[model samples]
Target: MRGLNDKVTLITGAAGGIGRSLVRRFLEEGARVVALDLDAAGLADLETQCAGHAGLLRTMPLDITDHAAVQKTVQAVHAEFGRVDVLVNNAGWDVAKPFVETTPELWDKLIAINLKGPLSLQHAVVPLMLAGEGGKIVNIASDAGRVGSSGESVYAACKGGIIAFSKTLAREAARGNVRVNVVCPGPTDTALLRSFTGDGEFGQKIYDGLKRAIPLKRLGQPEDIPGAVAFLASDDADFITGQVISVSGGLTMHG
Candidate 1:
């Protein structure tokens, strides 16, 4: 949480469950936030929610999957905010279904949101970070990436790609003092998770099974994530890079 005051932070997926939580947390930490999301209405509501925060909030309507659009936004953000201090790649989408049962169209959407969007953002932001002399990039991947998840083969692949990409980028960006790392969430109760689990008995069964499987006897909450994310984005994590931290309530662990 240290050294975050007045920092220029950009977060994608700014309207969703975890994304909104991250925005609120960063603002509370006194960071100037550039909240980006495709949901303009949600961004407006988020701005209202951020009324009394010490830091400033600027919302932008953006589709992360659009490469040229991402570049333009990054440039515009830099022009307005002066420089970006941190970038949180949190926008992602997917549906739960067996790989064979899933269609290529779904695969395209999965790759575009989960993989390509972050890739494009990184491509645009890293240079600005290099020019600014330093920055932090905290990618929100998934435990599915670390330890595969059923009904999420393509999504897991995209997340796994993110894990690999972050480490490589961290190593390459170290000379510029630009740190990169990943946070992999477990079975969090979010809108996306609701979509993953169908209604009634099916959803309950999956949710209960996850609780029983996890070392902790409950599903993860959206609020449980931002602390780790903020830590990674703050100066407290100056020495930590190329690492993947799992926020999965002990459901996933690495030595």
Candidate 2:
């Protein structure tokens, strides 16, 4: 879209399933992107994949939960690109265990990666956005947060927290010309999902079950997420903020 043309966008968790899709989509839209991920190898792969795109892509291997590192990276982005016009906080980790089985440490890790990571990134970027004209922020939440999923208690809690955080941030940032929103994605065919299932048989069963539950009778793809993200990040969504739009296949309709 014209909204994203020539813009500088930063995507956290850029090496993951949906994250990589977002990087590719944004690049195709003519946006220069800074792709950040904890996996150095994945980041390298992304760099290789986008090699021909040249000036359109920059990869950063980062742990988003590290506040100092996030700040440093963000500052570097500003120095390099002059401004960050759009930010997609898409990096997250999940622990699929019952609430009783979840240790305090495990809980903390989930909260740190899912909630605190976004908080830290926002703190680092919002001031720069204020100094600039305006900016867009799209947080990748989950349907689990909207409708609780079994074996993902803490993960759901963190995602729910992100939704709330985005709403409040939207209100606070609006006056500064900054727009914030949330995109809740359904079960997608991602490496993370396969990990949750553990093996071929179990993974197939899980996918089948999810497909049955979804009204569309199919699972989402990584490609399904980025279009919504790109929309929210674009000027097309300038008037839309504090909204939680689900990208599920009519799995949970809250209205």
Candidate 3:
């Protein structure tokens, strides 16, 4: 793996499970990271956790769904770091309910967070990447998007849209030396998973059922994801673009 020494990386949802893992991993790899998330307290906690690594990490609290806020945050990142070489669109939200129960309000929220957020981030960052001559973008999608999932109709749809958007953006941006790709994590052990499955015994039962179906016999850790993100964001994946790599512990396969 190529070292990211001095590289500037921006990761949205940086206060969340997978996002926080990615931020730490990238910093460990010697990159300067701009961490963006909606959770102010979480972001502050992460800042404290990474305090010893001065100049290596900067936390920005922002709502990705807000276009103006995203633009401002992107600008601030560039101002702080001078350039952004990697953009990880890792922020997302979902609602778990039967398709019949999914109202338009819920549908809009899913799309706004999962699809539009990434779109907004890309809009705000790509030009900066182009201006800097090159960059990488990795969208953290889900296997639920690839194969569909119960109680995640709108969520799946939004994720699927991310996959499609990444491909198109990859093709369009290649000439500018920008690479775009998607990482589809399957049933990861994240706060979002807990929220989706509900509380206590009921959640454990649902998790256990999913675990039994996965060939790896377990859920993935947030740590399991950053390696793929790091690889995709590094020179090692320079020739790779418009691809979907499933980090799902063999939970799903695509030909």
Candidate 4:
């Protein structure tokens, strides 16, 4: 939490369940936050929900898959704030289905939103960090990426790519004092998670099985995620980079 006071933090998917928690956590840590989401209405709602911290928050509707738009937004943010101290790549989308049941179109969409979107943000923000006071990047990946998931083959692939990407970027940016890390959440109780239940019996089965298998006996809550994310984004983590931390409650453990 140290060195975060008045720091500019940019979070994508800022309107979703976990995203909202991330925004609130940063704001509470005294960080100036820019909340980006394609859901304008959700962003507006987020602003209302964080009314007490209104002065510290700014909401922007962004489609991260749009390279030009991403560049423009990053430039605009830098122009106004002079620097971006933290970046949280929390935007992602997925569907629960067997790999063979998925189509090429689905694959493209998954890749673009989950992988390319974060890369675009990195491309735009890393340069600024390199040129100015360095920054921290916390990417939200999934346990599905570390171990595999039965029905999320493509999504898992994208997240695995994120883990690899973050590690490589951290190595490249360390000289500039830029830190990049990943937070992999296990099954979290979020709108996205609920959506899977509606997909069919397979989805429901996966959800139920996850709850039973988790050593903690319950799905993760959105609020459970921020402490880890905020820590990784703060001066306390200055010595940490290129590492992946799982937020899941014993659902998946790795050395």
Q: Whose lDDT is greatest here?
A: 4
lDDT of 1 by residue, 1-255 (tens): 899999999999999999999999999899999999999999989988888862489999999999999999999999987899999999999888999999989999999999999999999999999998699999999999998999999999999999999999999999999999999999999999988777999888987898898898899999999999999999999999999999999998774
* Residue 144 Cα positional deviation in candidate 1, in Å, after optimal superposition: 0.3
Considering summed lDDT, which 10 consecutive residues are worst modelled in model 4?
195-204
Winner on lDDT (3 vs 4): 4
Q: What range of 10 consecutive residues in model 1 has the weakest lDDT sum?
A: 47-56
lDDT digits (tens) for residues 1-255 of candidate 4? 898899999999999999999999999999999999999999999999999999999999999999999999999999999999999999999998999999999999999999999999999999999999899999999999999888899999999999999999999999999999999999999998888777678868878887999999999999999999999999999999999999889988876
Could you tell me the lDDT of residue 168 within candidate 3?
A: 98
For model 3 the TM-score comes to: 0.97
Runs of candidate 4 with Cα error greater than 4 angstroms are 199-206
RMSD of each: 1.0, 1.0, 1.0, 1.3
What C-alpha lDDT values do all the predictions have?
0.94, 0.92, 0.91, 0.96
Model 1 residue 236 lDDT? 99
Q: What is the Cα-based lDDT of residue 88 in candidate 1? A: 99
TM-scores of the models, in the order given? 0.98, 0.98, 0.97, 0.97
lDDT agreement of model 3 with the native = 0.91
- Residue-wise lDDT of candidate 3 within 206-251, one digit each (tens)? 9899899989999999999999999999989999999999999998
Report the poorest 10 consecutive residues by lDDT, candidate 3.
1-10
Clashes of each: 0, 0, 0, 0
